[model samples]
Target: MDLSSQNRRQVLQTLGIATGAALLSNTVSAKNAVLKAGPAFKYALNMSTIRGHRLGFIKELEVAAKAGFTSVEIWIDIFQTYLKNGGTTAEAKKIINGLGLTIENAIGFAKWIADDDTTRKAALKQLQTEMDQLAQIDCHRVAAPPFGATGLPLLNLDILADRYHAILKMGEQSGVIPMVEMWGGSENLKTISQVLYVAAASGNKNALVLLDSFHIYKGGSSVESLALVNKNAIKVFHVNDYPAGISPQKISEPDRIYTGDGVTPLKQILQLIKNPDQPVVLSLEVFNESYYKQDALTVAKTGLAKMKAVTAGI
Candidate 1:
């Protein structure tokens, strides 16, 4: 039917508005679907929890998947050892995908922030190679702890910031992110404040800090300060607890216990670090010798259960 110009214009405008509304509704629905499919926080098993078992790389992944963990954080040395033993990245990726698992992040002791120019250069080269390898397996993040410079005569924070910034730029090229990790036993970057400062001073938008519940206590950092941290700055958080009897100065890696099994204020810390825009990966990391004595699959299942209990209703 023929219509007046004004009627035609009005009809077109109405149709456009309807179409836009439908599109917006669909977008909202898609987002909600994604959120519902995942939990408020993604639970991941850090391979260190079972490293003492000496399970090969593939077996470790299999054990985690059997324990009902779809996300994991692997150690770089173990992964490389698999390669040294004739495992290919393609084969690793196939195995991971087949088991419905994702490598959330990797634990590497790269001395990317060393004070020595030669050491730092070598570390960066090593990291680049590791990043390239990890990317092939769909793993895009690795821990950047103060490995070489974690002893007496602490390194300058400003210098460390620049070094971190350098590796972050390298990460840009490899689609991998190096998360500044705080080590409880390390003399440097052991506190939330120090790590946060390094990340902020990096001047890179992709700067991220990897915090650990055990480290927070071991470093003697106040748990309340976590609220001051920008949620997006933390991508993966190491979830573990420690015995209250051990002082921060005396607490060791082997002292790390499963979440809710010890005295860490996990609920408060989880709430503080929870990202509203995205799911923050809660990786269960521990080094308790007792746990190591147990079967790897049993240990993994127990860790996952403990993590879920602590984060329940958070």
Candidate 2:
């Protein structure tokens, strides 16, 4: 081959190598960018944060979506009111999907754990109806707090487990999972220990617990206890903070402040509840009257920002 032909061949080979290297570098950089774009946790807004504004069902959902939240926790009573006022489940599903929001769970006051047989039966019927409605809206979880049994004469744990198992059975039919919830002020199932005990005794693999930071403090359960829980069992966590001075016994629902604004050891608690398989839904649930008095959009935006700030770098 002539000297010029040899030189041309060498030049083309060098250019090819350079182009290949550039392409590989670009691919790696693109992958890293995609990873960074996805957050490690999911954020949600519990309608209770803006419930005081009385935005109603659809409006509250609209405000949440406008604030950049794609997930929400709704109250069953407000939802039923909307239905009574001529809103259908099909319409509710359309509006929610149109807003690009998912109802992660619903808060209901069904007396599923009551000691009275007739009352319990009626409560189960109510839950079945609510579950059917929630299923239609594509919401698969509901809070099963000890509403009626929170008063005197603490119920037996074994019986509570049986009751919870029954509720779970009903949920199976509707494709909805009932999450056993704890109320700090309640007489029964007021602590993480009690909740875990009931869940374990229920002997159902699908039994899950819904926890709240405020309720943990109210019930006098240590945030560190979260480390003992199976992270997968906590599908959705209610995030909030409490001031340093107020005693748990004195603290009320109205005292809940935005995440990271109070004295809750949120960082550690979040780390404890971190699941290796999937991101946990952190739902902001505060009922501060001050927040309720503000513009609903502003409140929703602030709550989302606070949640993001607290979960940043986790």
Candidate 3:
């Protein structure tokens, strides 16, 4: 049927308005989905937690994939085993990307805070090597633990800070950021104050606060402690849950728990981070033999579930 020009124009305008309204609704739906995430669910399994499985890098990658984890943190030993067993860097990357996961940051022993020039240089070179490995995996950061320096009566805090700055300079050159972690039981930087002090000394933009759930607890710091840290300075958090029995004074470092399964103030701590948009990967970093005794998939799956439930309230 032929219609008047005015009627045709009016009908087209109505259709356009209706279509626009529907599009707006769809957009809001997608936005609500994202906000419902509230924050990213970048759950990762720490290989150390699943150490009972005795799985190496490739096997752990498979286990993580099967268990529905998109990423994991691997230790230096795992990577060494991978390369020792004819595992190529390219092959590892393919396995990771194929399963859609990341190497994340590694926990390695490096004494960048030392009094000796030779030792410091060696440490920097070691950091460089670690960064090279991370770069090959397309990872942007490495976790540097202040290990192997204890029992030496080391009073060179300034020297160590300087040394860390040098390592960070090297890391920056290679497009890697080195996060200085707080070792709860260390003589120095055993608490957040010390870690923050060292991190502040670097004065380099790449230096950051690497929060380990267990360490934070052991440091005698509370959930409120997160308020004191510069949100921008926090690189990422190493998430794990642990009971109070695992005191900072003892129990060694291999007894972290799945989130919400322990006494840690997980939700309050999570709520502490100022910005939700800043790439905070809630990596499930545990070291419990019990969790490892279960299937690696079970460990990952349970860790993810617990983390979700704990953070859900926040």
Candidate 4:
């Protein structure tokens, strides 16, 4: 059947439209799959909760795994010490895998926000070292607290953003993401707004923020502020409560209590940050001195139980 030139052009245009529509649908589906939430509550324990027990890296992993925690965060210092004492990442990965647990994130002081140029260089170098170790264990997140900037007046947020982007770009090469965390006592970047701005300003699509309940209350930010954050930007949320009696000014690290023992509005907080498709790690981070006196395994079990109880519904 001979067709007119106009008919041929119309058929070609129709095929192009159909092809474009199919491509759009597939793209949307892949993006949605990445954001689709996992289990309503994914529990993770930060090693700090049992730091006083002085458990080794492998021992701590054992404690978390035996306690039924699917995920755990490690401290950079401990992992470094393990290496200093002749430990290997391959060995660590074997132990972690054998126990059926995943390393969710890590805690490190990068000092990347220092006002001094030389200091900033040192911080990034240290951060890359830590990130390299984390990547070996398949961990892709690290906490970026205001380590050196703490108690100092706010530095220029724009400068901070640029510095953050620098490390984030390095992370791209190292396969890890640095989470700009809030420190309630910090003189800089202590609030959700400040952290979010730095992250957004970095212009990296992988920018993320780490939230801690204690820091939120300590920094004098209301729990409601969490709702303003983009949920995808939160990969790890530190779960701990602070005492009502202690004023924010006087609060210290040792004051952190278990998840439900204190007065933080955790349920409402979770409801705001909880993503249904992507798994948000609820990491237990506490420094209560009393917990250090108990057996490390006991502490791990208790912390995991409390975390589960508070995160019960979603």
Worst 10 residues of 4 by lDDT: 33-42
Work out the TM-score per prediction: 0.88, 0.88, 0.84, 0.87
Best candidate (score: lDDT): 2
Residue range 163-195, candidate 1, lDDT tens digits: 999999999999999999988778999899899
Tens-digit per-residue lDDT, 1-314, candidate 3: 45798899999999999999999999999899787755544667777778778888888888888888787887877787789889887888888899888777777776676556788778777878878887888878778777756545635566667767887888888877888877776666667777777788777777887887788877676667788888887656888877776556775666777888778777777778635656567787777877767888888788778877877745
Global CA lDDT of candidate 2, please? Answer: 0.93
lDDT of 4 by residue, 1-314 (tens): 45798899899999999999999999999898766735766799899988888988888888899988889999989998998999999999988999999898999998988988999899999999999999999999888888999867779999999999998999999999998999988999888889989999999999999988888888888888888899999888999987788998899999998888988899999999988767788999998899999888888899888988998876
For model 3, state the Cα shift of residue 16 in Å.
29
Clashing pairs in 3: none
Q: List the residue pairs that clash in candidate 2.
A: none
What candidate 2 gets wrong by more than 4 Å, as runs, is: 1-38
For candidate 4, give the lDDT: 0.89
Q: Which stretches of candidate 3 lie over 4 Å from their true place?
A: 1-41, 152-156
RMSD of 2: 6.2
Residue pairs clashing in model 1 are none
Q: Model 1 off-target regions past 4 Å? A: 1-38
Q: After best superposition, candidate 1 residue 261: deviation in angstroms?
A: 0.9
Tell how far residue 297 is off in model 2, in angstroms. 0.4
